[model samples]
Target: MDNVEVPDYFICPISLQIMKDPVTAATGITYDRESIEHWLLMRHNTICPVTKQPLPRDSGLTPNHNLLRLIQSWRRSTGNSPGAAAQMDKRKTQETSLNQSHIDKLIRGIGNPDSQLKSLQKLEALAIENEPRRKQLVEFGVHNAALHFIMQCHRGKNTNASGLPEALHVLYLIRNSSNGLKLSQMEDVIGEIIEAFSWVLGCDGETLNKTHAIFAMKMVVRKAKSAQLRMLKPEFFQKLVDYVKQRGNKQGINAALQVMLDSSPWGRNRIMLVEAGAPFELIELELKSPEKKTTELILGILFHLCSCADGRAQFLSHAAGVAMVSRRILKVSPAADDRAMLILSLISKFSGTNGVLLEMLRVGAAAKLCLVIQSNRESHLKDKAREILRTHSNAWKASPECLNLPTLTSDDVC
Candidate 1:
């Protein structure tokens, strides 16, 4: 890293102005960490200005002390456009009442560093002459601005809205686009949400994804909690998978997948996530864009499904699908034993009765399992494969044709 040249664009958005105390000109944003800290280590602050919520940070990047933070940092290496979320806090009644500092403090007070939320009763009392300020506070708030402020930095800051606007028009585009395009949007949203949760709210991705806020927006709704927000899920998921296929971007893919896994619970907003065409779609996609990791993910999903009696039955019931999957595993031959163990787990799920077990044997799956025990070098995998082998060994002992075949070892009685 010492030898690595830090590009000029790597300059902090706050520091581009060359101020000793650089601040986000557009969002009036500042972090507990700053530019130099960010340059030294990427971990600083990803907090939202209005919510005082710190954004979630991923383990993939290093920690920085002085950087403006990813929210301020990741907006661009060069920097944010600064106008989309920009607003005028102009005074009305033909005269201004307070200075910008007062206004900034008041707005920040809504999500004060300590605890900014004013009581609703207090808010109602304050609204006698200053109702517009309350509306202003709400508009400037990060929870309300989660999608808007984040998206505004990219576009539509100039678009009119007294408060957070419906972003479904853009979200619909994000949802309907191909897996590739939707992923790009998901990246932006993930980064923004991370920034919101970690920097603004100071929670990790694990917490944010699991929170009621996320669920309120994404899961558990007659029509997804927040329809626009819901549009992003499948797109985000599909994109992580796409990254693995197109670039072999292991680090990137894993980081993206981490977001999905964190966001694991079906927001219940839509079924597109857990039951989207993803698992089935992946089989075809992976054949062309095979990545060891994506294969592992697919295998993990199948393993999860196969673990339950009902799930296993359903998984096996899709005989055509199972056949395709078995062939895919064959294609991944010389695959790690862990992968073989994963396959063996799936195999173990099925009833080893004549039909299914014989079908597995006929499809060349049994031969493959036998080969796994004979050939695997990984100890953990080998041990599990041996356990599975014991199951098959019983079958071999029961059938004369298998009994006549080569023995696993001389110690075995014929």
Candidate 2:
């Protein structure tokens, strides 16, 4: 690791030599700001600035305290540096310039009546000796960078060229973008990636596919406030919520429940649990969350609602609403002692009015619970499930209402 003995295969692509710059490559990857991610994806201290090679991303140069000062200097030179957002209006004429490649594409685009990608290719090739144009191209392209990465994961004969890690880089960008900031009004791109999950992982795609999609979606949801992803447009949030609530495999719920409590803002906290159905009042309460009993309280609220005619109505109407409550009762809190109690509460709530309990009971939910309890490894659960079965069965003993539910079984339970 000494200055003289640089790592092998770690050459900078830009310079085609030892790396140098804010950070240099220490591994085989040579992508830099020009070719690397706009977010300074690499940060190793020394290497051929040109080659952009590196040992590995994990071991790359760590940011030093002076990183702020370096950032300031970069801003000064760029004029339109990020913090200079306020001053952009003053330099409208002199504002951010377009790269030569983009300009070239625009000019050549007039006559090139052939393929659209060929036009883009001509544009991509404008990298040579066109510094200003390159900068513009980079900035403009940043808007859709996440999209291109996602498209790389789609089904096709050419998919092998679209590596999984490369696909993950798109996800990494989505998850780690500053303040969880995401592009604005961009549903088509995000939708394509999510909808194709089953294709990406093949037949086994359902579990892993939902896991990754939920992870990124939650991160974006957590960071949003007063702003939905610009790219997702105004209604896109609802669409994303529906994606998980209905299309998601069972695993999506597990991932949604795993976000750390403290890091979550109240709005996100509420939305995280209730999906998009989180009301403004609920979100406010979630701000003071983590009071030791918050989870229980939320569960209590959920129980009172789950079996009610209105609650079921809400669930049936809103996909997110269904996911929010079901995740707590079934996926996340299943093993908790109170889970069965919550289900019982719901069952009782619907006892006189609606039809959930009757439907479930008719479907042999009583027998199903008994079987689950009997087979459960935890004796406590066995007892709890058995008690619930008994309670449900006996509830009808006193001239009980008949269940109109169609028959369901253990297979459907799974």
lDDT of 2 by residue, 221-280 (tens): 454443333223323333333433443443353334332232223334333434445222
lDDT of each: 0.39, 0.39
Worst 10 residues of 2 by lDDT: 1-10
- Candidate 2: regions farther than 4 A off: 1-240, 243-309, 314-341, 349-357, 376-380, 395-414
Model 1 lDDT tens row, 136-191 = 33333322323434344234333232221212111211221132121322443554
Score candidate 1 by TM-score against the native.
Answer: 0.38
